[model samples]
Target: MTRRGATRNGLTRRGVPAVLLDVLLVLVALADTWANVDLGQQPAVSCALLGSFALLLRRRLPLTTFLLTVPTAMVSDAVFATLAALYTLASLSRHRVLLACCALTYAIIDFLPWPWSTLRANELSGTHNVVHLIYAVATAAAPVFLGQLVQARRELSLRLTEITEAREHERLLTAQGVLARERAQLAREMHDVVSHQVSLIAVQAGALQVSSQDPEAKRGAAAIRRLSVQTLDELRHMVSVLRASGSRPTELTPQPSLADLQRLVDGSGMEAELKTDLPEGLSPPVQRAVYRTVQEALTNVRKHAPGATATVRLHHVNGRVEVTVTNTAPTRPPLPLPGAHHGLLGLRQRAELLGGTVTAGPTPDGGYELHLDLPREGAG
Candidate 1:
């Protein structure tokens, strides 16, 4: 069952026992009053029995129960049931009706016979009956006041429960959304791993054709390379998702920026010259995009141009940050690398996401260059 439904069912199940308890208590009180009281003795006792029965519907029809018990309290010894009804009404915030009902109960208890014996004594002695009337009024008011105060506390508790439930539901939704994004990312990672292995197979086939002089081997190698590249292009989007998602942190943490650029270069274990004039106060996303751009550029040069020397430049000017990576041509012939050539594409996607652009190609002086320009403000 849904949470609210379960809560309501729980209330009903608990309420049944409480209703039975109230009926039992009211009946016991009536039996005690019937044995002792002597005011309007017959009518009072019969009406008290009827009013106690009315208490059964207190939760469902509190007003009806109160109306039935109030008249009975005037003549009957059923004051206990009437007082219970008054409290129920007050707790429900029915102050206006309770005022009228309480006024009548006070008048009945004071003017009508409290027990007929007291009324007869006051009549015979000609006493003012001041103390009894005052006592009766106070008795009527006590439970109503208590009920109102208790009702305020109950309402406050209910409000707090609702607020807590809403916050918990919101947290659940947020966690589900994060899990969904993570699953999409994991799928992409699997694709990249598989595609890179296939690219290596294609690369080895090409190398085999070069080393051997057999025409059949050459033709097979050419076919493998062509088919592998085609498949890579077809699954380009999935590979792109993997390349971008793999760089992200799975937990909340400070994102990498230009400050981390040197660490990135050093971690690669590549001998490359680095330069930086990057400005401070860039947004986190822009910083991450810039850092990833440079990182991808260097990694690509290492993959495609082995044994090449590389130079990286970072510049900040006119509310924009520009990073460029340039590398000299490899002295040795190109060797097959287990990379899918998707790094540059991922960099392009990241830069564009920040409303920027990336340019990468072979340089004129027997080298390759990758350039990225990102604006600092409104770059989200």
Candidate 2:
């Protein structure tokens, strides 16, 4: 069963047994009172019946039951009154109700005399002895004490349940937060890769327009368009993989790795020089992280550094993979702009999630540098 269903079932199981026991107690108390009081004693028998029935519903209506049964028991001297008072004092909704019930019970029983009064000189001491007062007080007080004990136990159980539920809620929220962060990182990656491919298509398409007479140029432009379209389809498929969870279907997929770094270098065409030193068999996630870091770094170089030559370096060392991309600064400084840099921030966040780090800043030799590190397999 689900957790909620199991909890509810457990409560029902515990309560049903307690209710049955209470009903049996009521029956016993009623039988004993009826046997003790003669049928001629109308007031005592009526009181016994009222108090016994009240015990049956004490859990549901504790305060009312206590009030109704207390007065009748004092008059009739019935056992049912004692039991009902106990149930009320222990199980009532609040301390105020319990206190009120206790005071009312004592007042009712104290006012009524026992089986005989001192005024009747012929009456035996056994009929109106100190024992009657002790018995009456003990019976009335016992239920209240029992009720308090039960209340304490119930409160403890409730607090424990609240603590358990809070922890479960926190766990669920943490999982959802993690999933949201992963989705955002994926979006950033998709933007970088897809934008680079689309930019190539646009550049090639523009060249074809200006050099319409050159057949070779037109053919190259058409090829770039087709390649961009194919890559877009694959990008969509990868995004689908992210959004779904199940057994993955195998296919001939061209996932970018160190080999593809050459293509990117060629595409940049001397805007930057790419030097890679990847191990023989890196995990797919590490490979992807490496490829994305390079792509984003180079893209930034193209946009910000312009004519400034940049160098890309990667190496595996000391249970970690390190990447450093450095580019010489331009002779003239660029103007500082206002808006935040989301691209680099997103890249750093992605790196941190993999237990890695990214550092980017100006170098001593009038150049900009970005460094990244990914923890090696089994080095967590």
Candidate 3:
């Protein structure tokens, strides 16, 4: 491949017009022949023309054209074709450095003792020969230096382009990371403000209902307690959907369902019972809402009604699914702690979006109850 590339480049168009250089070489041949060749020596004239005209083929056949000029160059004063061919050969040919060294030596030897030059071998001083040698070496180095610069520039430009593309890719990935974190922050903020308040209300109402003596006051307290508890439950389900990692299918495996409620209770590290008269294969949306409703209700029970037993029930009645989760009265007040109640509003949004309704209030026996209704079709 390297050899092929060198061959291809040898034939490529030049910055200095190739045809004009060829003509200049030919003119040098004519000038030298007129000045030095005797009228009878037509053979010497023919050899000079052969060397100069060979420049037309220098690019197309760089090495071959250079060899063609060597014999003619040793005898004739005209050596432009020889010099031009050496330049192309050094620049575009394979083994460029090695070839340049060899050609430099050849140029000095070929030009130094040429028969047509003014200084003959017998009269040539050591100083004069050194000067001639320097001239030849300089001539050879010029073209080789120009070609090396062109190759260097081409390689540098290509490397710069690669670096630019890599930087753009890195920037794109960084921008995406920033955007994802910003979205997750928004989800967290909503949960903090809403979930904390609803959970707080539910816990307080339960205590108030148990403490109240008047029938009216007790009933009012029960209603408030149930609503708050149920609101808290709904929010958990809604927020869970958002909080699950949607970016990966593996992370989004099926959520807890009606059958899975027992498992949820067992793993909850709390005392709870689950009962269901509901059939299997509920639509995913309804199932998720139902599971979340029950899950959140039980969570609130654990949080506020310590030592309370939560009872979960599922019913399929009148083309609808009904889920009820209730807890016994708390033996002790809940721990006073800061909370993020952000999930309450999110729960309402979940039920409404799925065409379902959920409610929570105090039970008659100084406890709390949460109920949710979703239609058989698309959660009604």
Best by TM-score: 1
The better candidate by lDDT, 2 or 3, is 3
What TM-score would every model get versus the actual structure?
0.46, 0.45, 0.38
Q: After superposition, how far is residue 351 of candidate 3 from its true place, in Å?
A: 35
Q: TM-score of predicted model 1?
A: 0.46
Q: How badly does each model clash, as a count of residue pairs?
A: 1, 3, 17
How close is each model in CA RMSD to the real structure? 16.1, 13.0, 14.8
Candidate 3 C-alpha error for residue 261, in Å: 38
lDDT of 1 by residue, 1-380 (tens): 43221224324335655645666767765775676456466776667777778877766677788888766777655577778877777776546675667655655664567466655554634345666566677877887787787777776878999999999999988997787678677766657686788789878977987987998678657766766775676556554544454366443334687788887776543568889877788787887887788778776776778778888898888988888899999877776868776887888888888888999889898899989888876354
The lDDT, on a scale of 0 to 1, for candidate 1 is 0.72
For candidate 2, report its TM-score: 0.45
Residue 212, model 3: lDDT of 82
Q: Per-residue lDDT for 1-380 in model 2, tens only?
A: 43211224324336656566667778877886776667687877777777777776665566677766765556664555556555654654557565655755664465456643544743326655556666656666666677667767767887999999999999988997788679657856886777576767767776674678886566546656655665677776766665443336435466787778878765652357777767778876677777888888876765676467888898889879998989888644554545467878977887887889888999898778989898865234
Instruction: Report the lDDT tens digits of candidate 3 across residue range 1-380.
Output: 44422433333334555466567776876676577556566776777677777777766687887887776667766666666677767656657666767577566656566555576657556787778877777776777777666656656766898999999999988887777676567558658978898878888888888988987677657767766775777676655555553364223344666677777777554568888888877887888888788777876887788778888888999988888888999988987766586454556677878777778889899899988877866534
- List candidate 1 segments past 4 Å from native: 1-16, 38-40, 95-129, 173-380
